[model samples]
Target: MKTAADKLSPTRVKLTVEVPFDELKPAVEAATKKIADQVQIPGFRKGHVPTRLVEQRFGRPAIMQEAVNDALPDLYQKAATEAEIKPVGRPEVEITEVPGLDGKDEGDLIFTVEQDVRPEIDLPDFSALEVEVEEPTVDDDAVQVRLDQLRERFGTLVGVDRPAEDGDFVSLDMTATIEDEEIESVEGVSYRIGEGNMLEGLDEALLGLSAGETTTFTSKLAGGEREGEEASVKVTAQSVKVRELPEADDEFAEMASEFDTLDELKADLKEKAEADAKGNRVALARNALLEKLLDDLEIPVPDGLVQEEIDNHLRNEGKEPGDSHGEEIREDTVKAIRAQFLLDEINATREVSVEQSDLMGYLQQLSAQYGIEPNQFLQMLAQSGQLEQIFAEVQRSKALDVVLADVTVKNESGDVLDLELGGSEDDADADDASDDAADEAETKPAAKKADESGAAEQETAEDVKAAAKTPAKKTTTRKAPAKKAPAKKTTATKAPAKKADAADEKDAKESGEKDA
Candidate 1:
């Protein structure tokens, strides 16, 4: 057997393979037995028919074809290994020649395959890279913002006779109609002004409206039967109320937190804010490094992968392939794939592997984030078959850390900061899964943020539904609308795996070569 690869492009290859007839006899015999078990022959028990008899009935050409079809997978795998190419999708197999089928010659089986593969990357030196991170400085205003957020949790809405303002709570009745046909209506729903949790333009329309005032606005419905359709929504402002926060004092501190004094609470919040500032800096530095690397290097994305991802994104959003956002999604997908290849090359160079402890730590963090038990989270992941996806995330994160450790990070003040690579210290001596819960309590902020934000929220939601024995509770507090502004979230998007190679096996089964 011999296999060689020809580089067709940066992201594709053509593999040529030659397998002598001797190597194919096993597949031939296996195919013969398979056919014998399926066919009815007098005096010969099922699965016991001799190969010669089966061939005489089915013809030698048919037998050879079936044998070749059956053997393609293992042969392809071997060829890929010899060529040192990691294929992303099933190869397009072309059998150039087959042995002993024509009864004129018995020779090696020869085939060629064209497929997308992981591209070769010319990685830059990590040591030479320098990223400027924000100087770690937590102002009193930052701490006050956090303190205000905590205070809001314990605040009460007091009725006010004024126009609704930003941060004011409102009780409203809304009827949505498309062309005078009422599609949906809600009464006495509580909404915070400027929180665009509902339709696109509801917040803007709600502004400057007092109690008992009625207004109508046209906006695209967000969800339900009329999702994405334009609807004329008439809103009646039943009342306006403002959140009356408790005064920041010892008494309020005692009620809102475990701390007994306002000073203690402020001190704690300040400390947390500082830590968060550090985390933000770390995230920024790492991102700056990645951005620099991406800018400096020339990476070609596979066209097939980008289009496949684009189609998948549209499908998930219930939109057509030609959706307006298709080009934007394509650009992001291409960048993501390039980053994946670059990180993967670095990961390979560093011999990064997700240990069992690492995976458990990841699961623990996920469980805590979703407010479920670790066991329940594990069950959800297993049921949803995303355990590998999680594993891939942890591995890529560690790989990113490896790159971070090698690079030099400096703050704006020109001082070198001490950087801690998340999960690296305790990765060794991770003997107990039970201990992982405690270990994850100390994960670096950037790593934790990456884990939480890297995967789609829908994936976790689906998993939760599958794993929950009881239905999840319904809550009236609407999620604060996505900020009108895009937040700078430093997430290293890992490229998703192409559909499983099992499709290749199915293709072989359906080739009709076995019945030729």
Candidate 2:
């Protein structure tokens, strides 16, 4: 077989291949034998039919077609190997020249294969890239806040007749109609005001409503409403309930948790929050390290990868992906492919490998989540023929994790710490300050007017603290500070006077000695 390759573009390649007639003999013979076995010939068995008779009946053109069909796989493989093309999809093969049976007995069978190949990648250094991320800081206040949430989780909801406050639960009845015909009406739906589980407006809509008041609103149905249609929802407040929080004392701590004292419980919460914060910091740092590893990466995405992904998506949905989504998915597919390449390079550099034990453990965890035994899940997977795919996914995840593990992790403090992403030391304080400031500014306009007043107050506080250690000022004049004034004058007088006395004493002794 003779072959030549042409580089069409970064993502596409063309291979022109030629196979001589003599090299195609085995394939031709096999096809003829296969046809002979299929056709019925008088006085001969199905398997024992003669090749000459079969060829004479079926004709040589049919035989040549069969031969080409049989030889395509081997020929394509050889051509790809020779051209060094990592073909991404099934090639569009065009036969340029076909063998003529009698007139030109032996000639080259030329074919042109056009297909997309894997894009070449030029990766950048990991150490050169840097990204600024908010560091994790989980302080004592955050721990206490989280502890409060945990305590509330154990507390029972009590119904009361009062205006809906921040920590109140409201019970309501709602009717959803598609076309003014009520589809479903839910009653006694107990929901927290800001949980956001229900439709977007429902929570905010329920916030101010009293126990006996009714409110009507429209919400878009989950499934597309009748092509450009919206649902009319009527919500009625059945009852307004408030959370009766237990006291935040030692007694409350003993009742709510295993801890004996409030301080101990608070300490425990702080520890938990700190641990979570550390873990988050490590995760962030790991990502940063990966970004650093992939500083100037440039890679051609494997052609057809995105389309293949879209096709796979459609396949899962039991439909073939149309050409409409081809261009749009390319952008996303390129991003995904780049990420994969970075991860792959990192894995290779670090020699990251996944263990079978880890995969089994992950599967067991998944099994537990789904409330099935590990073996039962495995059996189901085997029946579905997705067991290998699951393993491949596991391998890929473990490989990524290995890279993440080897990367650097540190908190915003630059203290070589591993902390959780959102959990931070000053988070509660920042939240509290922001909330109080905003609330005060809104409810009492005087505070917003008093921002300058607040800055002035802060300035006065600084002046008072500064003046505390310094000596008192002189009342005589508005001159420089008088505390250093006397010291300067005294040192000046004593030095000159001592020098004059020493000179006078030396002169007197010399005169008396000369007179003697």
Candidate 3:
């Protein structure tokens, strides 16, 4: 076999391949067998027809076409590997010539493939790059914020006769309409005033509404078939309530936490605030370093691939191919594709690899964010065929971490910050163990308390349900919303394979092929 690659553009390539007759023999035999199994012959049982008789009946050209189609994918993959080109999107394949078409198995199989590929990028020296991040510091205000958050967790919701205000929780019944025709409606939904997560102008409309009071507003629908379309929305507040927090004292500390006194609780909060500040600083530094690298490099994006992604995005949103959202999708898709290419090149250069522990840690973090059991989440990922994509993402992240380790980072005061971007394997293992131990310790006290108080289990279940409604933290890469049906007051189990599958599909829109 012989293969040659022609550079069509910075982000495109055309490969010409010639396969010897011997190389095509196996595919030919397999194709012959497949055809024989499908056809009925007078004196032969199904799938036991002679190759010569089948070839005579179907003609050599038909056999060659079948063999070519059967063997194309593997043949193209091998040729691309031999040519040393990292193809990105699907290739346009054309079979130019085939052997034995003229009743003589003399000529080699010839074909050409045109595809988009990763552009050659000259990465700048990482050691030469420098970025500044905020200094890791925990002030009294930060500690107070953490303490207040914890207090809120143990707070009780008391019914209020006054109008709803910011931070008040309200039970609401909502109805939406277009052109005086009701489009959607929901009743007895709990909403927090000023959260603004449900719809545009909802917070402002809900403010100042007392129990049994109704208000109307106009806003665009957030999702569904009429997403992005303006509609009239009416909301009725069923009841208004405000959270009454416990006093910051020894009694409150003992009831809310393991700490014996308020001072000890505050101290623990302060310590945690400090650790979070440091983690935030490290994340900021990493983002700054990545931004610097992206700015320094000139990576070409394939226009065809970008358009394909735009079409897919519109399709998924239930919009037409020429939807206005295509413009925005194109920009984001280009950036994501460029980032993927850049990280993939660095991954190859640094010989980065994903370990089993790395995958486990990532999966645990994701599962926690989505409020799903780790084992169940792993099963979902495997069922969706997204393990490989997840592995690639982890590899890219590690490659960036490798680059960050070599770069210099400083605080605003010009003091060099010792930001631990990525730690050694042993350190990672230790950190994981420490986290597990801390989680166990935290839960043990709660479990014991629950055993003492019968109603505590019901309260804990309610808390878990509330937490499940909270959105997951945003990551560098955008992910599709989990495909879980809403339950009355519990975290719904997600569909077996939609979240990761949608994400993988979105990222790899063009990572498939079609024969031309």
Candidate 4:
């Protein structure tokens, strides 16, 4: 066998391959046997027919076609490996010639494959790259917010006689109808007035509605058979309730936390808040550095692959292929593709690798986000053939960290910031906590939250400790962090809350829930 490659463009290649008749013999035999098993011949049992007789009955050309089709995938893979071309998306293949098609097995198998590939990238000197981020700071207001969040965890929901307001919890009975024909209904569902996770305009309609008051709104059904269809939704407030938080005193502190005094709890919250601010600064700096590289670099992206991604995105959103939103996302899609190509090249150059611990840690973080068991999440990744993709993502993140380490980052005040990208003491502690949590999860069944509106109220001190210890979501080239200066950082160099592909994450969560 032999292979040759022609450079069609910086990000595209065409490979031509030739194989001898002997290489096609095994596929030919297999194809003959397959046909024999399907055809009925007199005086011969199924699958016991002679190859020559099967060929005569099915025609030589049909046998040759089946053989070629059976062999193309492996042949193309071998040819691509030999040519050292890293194909990105699916390849367009054309079989130019096939051996044994003319009643003679003398000619060679010949074919050409056109494919998009990772482009060659020349990385700039990292030491020369510089970026500025806001100075890390923790104010009283921020600490108070954290304190309030913790307090909410122990708050009691008390029934109220007044109208529902923002931050109030409500028990609701909702029914959807089309032209007075009831389509769907749910009774006694607990919802927070301001969460906005329910139907659109629900918060607005519920506001100022007292217990037993009913209001009607027009909105599209988000799910069920009539999803996306506009309908009249009638909602009655069964009950209105307010969460009464415990006092921020020494006695309350002892009940809600490990600390015995309110001062001690506030101090710990302040320290965590400070760490969060520092993480935010590092995230900002990392984004600035990445943006600089993207702006200065010119990596060619394959138009065909871009279009395919755009079409997939639109299809996932249940929109037409030619939707105008495709155009809106085109710019982001191109940037994401370019960033992946860039980081991938860096990953190769720097010889970045994902260790077992790193992969496990990532899986644990993702599973926690989706509220599933870590082992179950790992199984889902393996079953979906996404383990490799996740590994690549981790490698890309580490590669970016390498680049960040060499770059100079400063705050707005022009002071050199000691940005701890990773491997910090806090990170190590978080990892330990996560590992412990995972072990506990494996040993015991997970406690499900009673209600989304009362999530904070259900959490214990241990949960709060784990929450404070965990870092921000790790980002990758595909899921670049927004280029905004955060009020407080969630991770040292992690991306914001959104995952790389929201749709994929949703699907994984749904599948994991079903499996559970």
Candidate 5:
């Protein structure tokens, strides 16, 4: 077998392959046997008939057709591997020649395959890059704010002699009636004034109401039989209370914190605030570095891949195929795909290995972030065929961590900040970042499933192997990235109060979608 590759474009390739007829003999024999078993022949047992006899009865055309059908996939795979092409979507195959149909000397089998391929990325020495992060500093006001929060937690609520106001806690009796019929009622419920945690307009109704005062307001019921229905709610303020914060002194500090004095507590709070600020600064610096890297590159993206991603994105969002901001989405998706590819290249160059422990750790983090049992989340990933994507994401993240470690990071004040790539105090919430990566996977464009044309059939063995190992998806976080990019810092988002399993039924169906 021999293969030749022609560059159709920066992101596409065409491979011409030739195979000797001898190499296809096994396939032809298999095809002949398959046909023999399905047909009835006098004086011969099923599936035991000689190949020549079957071919003589059925003619070589049918056998050749079946043989070619059975052989094309393996042949295509061989050609792709020999040519070293990373096919994205399916390939277009055309059988240009097949000799020996006339029972003469067997000649060569020839075919041409064209498909979109993963573009080659030229990665620079990312370790040499420099980025400026914000200096993590805790101002007195920030410390005071944290101190105030601590004080509020230890504060006592006292019965107030006046009407309720914002920040006041009120004990009230409430009854809901819809169309002259009572819906629900509660007695002695305590609510903080202006919290708006319950039905809308409840706070306004309670405003300026003295003890034993009654007020009626119309609002929609939040839940129950009359949910979303307008109801007249009558409320009677049973009592109003105000929060009284303890003074910031030694006694108060001793009661509220582990410190012996207010000054000690304030210093501790300031240190914590500074640490938090440092985390934030690291995230900003990482993002800035990635954004700069992406801005620096001129990577060419496949249009078909970009469009496919756009369509998938809009579809996932429950919008039409060509919704608004499609161009922006396309651009973003393209950048994301490029970033993954580039990082993958870097990961390979660095010879990064993802250990089993690393994968388990990543999944555990995701399990916590999604608020599901570890076994359950692992099952979901396996069921969806997303375990490979997750593994690739973890590898890519670690690769970025490597580059971040090598890069020089300075704060805005021109002071060098110590940034260890992994295991920094800021990484305590790295599991939160794993959630972001998973979410990004859920919304990743189908670059691997891009539209294809000009190929009669498609198969790429190398692609199958690579995909089985490294499926395409958003693998890392980025503020924005350029040609030669760096890692993005991790920022935590509030995990949903409800576990992901609550929506498992809805997600389970599409969990195995090719692109997240």
Candidate 6:
């Protein structure tokens, strides 16, 4: 047993397990005695039958079967201990050598265990880690959009005598038929003209009918068992109504409640819109910051996980990930895998984790997005086989939040970005990162060129790698980097302007989005 472990690696090992024949002897004796008692012999009483006679009748196979069964469990335990393997699931045991009573009296048990080992990780300087997050800010434009939506909600529809038009509210009686056979009909249904919220073609059919007027039309139902099922609608419009937008004056405002004038409403709407926008940007930044922190990670993502991610992407893209999405899928999967790995590493290091309550909280937020109750939404997720996925997502999010607490966040301009929970800073970073890398590449051609290498380029590539790993600056705090000034300072010397600055001035002559 001592020598067995010496041959195996510390991380994983296999052992040649043996159960001595001496250990099997007692079990064999007990079995033979039991058999002798059960069987009747002509010369001896059934209980008094000799062991040798029982052995002769049953032979070695029966004795060995009993011995093997008795010894297997203890043998397996001894072997696993000897190998020092933390068996995750189960072992596939094979009897390598079976003990025989004669020359081949003793047999050895051998088996192999394949399992995932807890990886030994190399920790970096956690305190030195820095990340950037865009802060949430309420903007005027965002508020305006919200206000417009609100205004639309407050507007009322009143009847008009002209041919029914868009945004009109019409009260009508309707009937459906195909080939002069009446299939379905209804009366006095209040349908919004040009708002196709219900059955197909009904709104458009109602647009032309006025009070006391009727129009007949036929069209197919969009999606139904009766798809391609044609229906004729006879609409008698009891009323035709258009939006009666309230007057922008103070008296109408007083009628609407809470506001003195339309301007005040618009301002409030603008503020809300801006707040929403800022909140959106902040949320995006938080997510982006988390993703970037994960970007620095190096780990082998399991093929099963990547394949799963690819399949999901393909399903969402509404096409097979094979061939077309293969490359894209691989790239995305690797990034996703890295992100998850980094978050896991952080979780392990800091002991931060998502609990069941965190998962419930996450579900509540998701439910809010769809305007559904949390429990109903949870049931939907459970029924759809998505509970685990949702749980994982929640964990990832919680992990990111913890990461934000631990990391230093700054912007490209070197200004410290504010952190917001559940923000969308990632999209901004994605855009800005590309721009930064592109700009960096434009200035650092030698570095980029050195990265493209074959045998001849190996030495230079190594040099580039060496340089990249070394920290050039200690930029732990948020501060916008200014154009580097020349060392020889004059009494009133201007700074050496950046090449990008020149391009910017050139762009200013053209439109904001025009080519530099």
* TM-score per candidate, chains pooled: 0.72, 0.57, 0.74, 0.75, 0.64, 0.46
Candidate 3: tens digits of C-alpha lDDT, residues 1-516: 999999999988988999999899998889899899999999999999998999899877777767776676678778888988766544566566677677776788777877777789898888888999877688999988987777776666678899999988777888999999898887877666765557779889989999999999998776655765789999999998887776888998898779999999999999877776765675677667766777879988788766655554454444788878778645555665566667777887896756777777766765654435689888876764545544555566667767877889999989888766556644453234323322221222111111110100111111211112111221111122333211100000112212212221221332221111
Q: Report lDDT (CA) for all predictions.
A: 0.64, 0.52, 0.64, 0.65, 0.64, 0.47
lDDT of 6 by residue, 194-220 (tens): 545456566667666668888887766
- Number of the top-ranking candidate, with TM-score as the measure: 4
- Predicted structure 5: clash tally: 12
Question: Candidate 6 overall Cα lDDT vs. reference?
Answer: 0.47
* Span of ten consecutive residues with least summed lDDT in model 2: 487-496
Task: Show model 2 residue runs off by greater than 4 Å.
Answer: 20-23, 98-109, 123-134, 158-258, 292-295, 302-304, 307-331, 348-350, 356-516
Off by over 4 Å in 5: 37-40, 140-276, 355-375, 422-516
Across 374-448, the per-residue lDDT of candidate 4 in tens digits comes to 797777667644455555555655677667878899888888887654353356433433343223222211111
Off by over 4 Å in 6: 1-109, 113-123, 133-137, 155-282, 308-328, 353-361, 368-373, 382-389, 418-516
Clashes of each: 0, 14, 0, 0, 12, 22
**Model 5 — which ten-residue stretch has the worst lDDT?**
485-494
Better of 1 and 3 by lDDT: 3
The window of 10 residues in a row where model 3 has the poorest summed lDDT is 485-494
Candidate 4: worst-modelled 10 consecutive residues by lDDT: 447-456
In candidate 3, how many Å is residue 460 off? 47
- Model 6 RMSD to the real structure? 21.4
Q: What is candidate 4's TM-score against the reference?
A: 0.75
RMSD of each: 16.0, 33.2, 15.7, 14.0, 12.3, 21.4
Alpha carbon lDDT at 363, candidate 4? 71
Alpha-carbon shift of residue 174 in model 3 (angstroms): 4.8
